[model samples]
Target: MKKVIVISAHPDDEVLGAGGTILKHSAQGDQVFWLITTNITEPDGFTVEMVSERQEEIKEVEKILGIQKTYLLNYPTMKLDSRIVNEMVPRISEIFKEVEPEIIYCLNRSDAHSDHRYTFDAVMSCTKSFRYSYLKQVLLYECISETEFAPALPEKVFLPNYYVDISNFIEKKLEAMNIYASELGEHPFPRSERNIKALATYRGAIAGVEYAEAFQLIKFIDKE
Candidate 1:
């Protein structure tokens, strides 16, 4: 079985961005693991105790998505430190020593979010020692919030080089998203589900699939 680890910046990113591929990988006998960098903790709105509850929420969603295992790093959302990247290196180095994934998928470095970009940088930098050993490919995925947006500057539009046909698994994408019931946004749009569906459709249209996911390829070793 091919060992795979998906490092995501926030909750629901894994499902939204790579749900179909994850399902496809696992169904083909790959063991997929998740390394989450954020915890769903709202001390004011949901109370501080919700972290543990959200932990359970993460697990349930992973199960529903048929993921093999998930590890939450509990990094703060939108706020990432440069030092944290160094800190994560050795730890992820250890994980690579153990799981030794054949593929690692992360957010693109040029993404809008700092945390997402930082995660991509750190994940790539840390694994240099294993350059041609364990990790063969590191692909970048687009999340609903992060991926669907046009660049703040006019010239910097997000372009996808490859697309996956997610027509069959879009329902599973929606199903997995339902687990994060506490993730309602402030009332301009209110619920995030509607937004998620719309983004999926949008990316789907861009990718030419009825419902699809998009990715940017970082390393194409054997490609000539």
Candidate 2:
């Protein structure tokens, strides 16, 4: 089984970004780990009950997604940009050293959320050069709302060149997403179940599959 890591700025970002792929990996017997950078429990205007609810939500998601392990850093939510890159990179690097993941998945750089952008930057910094030489491939997945709501600039557009067929795992992805009740909205909302399925169907159409997840490949080091 391959070692895999999915890094996200917050709890549900991974589910929205690449939940089907994570499920597919686990079903294939790969060891999947998650690194969530921020917790919603900060004093940035959230209540204790809300914090407790969000924590419980993630725990349920982990169980449903078959995540082998998780690394949760209690960084402030929605305030990742205020922190310096050096402060974030080392912690992620330490996780890399321990997990030694063969494949790394993270948020795309084009996301509108400041936390998402910062998380992508931090991941890039941590994996630069020979720091994590054992990494074989790196892929960036798009998060709904955050990625699609970005400005119409060409540089910020998410142009995915790779697709992973998730036809068999879309139901599991939707099931896992339902655990994050706080993050979901009505049908018309971007993070709604309808839109999530719609996006997957669109990607699958491009790949000639029933459902799929798309990604931008940042690097691939093949020793063969």
Best by lDDT: 2
**Can you give the TM-score per candidate against the true fold?**
0.83, 0.96
The whole-model lDDT of each prediction reads: 0.73, 0.89
lDDT of 2 by residue, 1-224 (tens): 89999999988899998999999999999999999988876478889889889888888988888899999877888888746556988888999999999899999897888888888898888776477877889999999989988887887688899899999999989898888876799988889999999999999999999999999998888962
Clashing pairs in 1: none
> What's model 1's lDDT at 148?
46
User: TM-score winner among the candidates?
Assistant: 2
Give the clashing pairs for model 2: none
Those runs of model 2 whose alpha carbons end farther than 4 Å from true positions after fitting are none
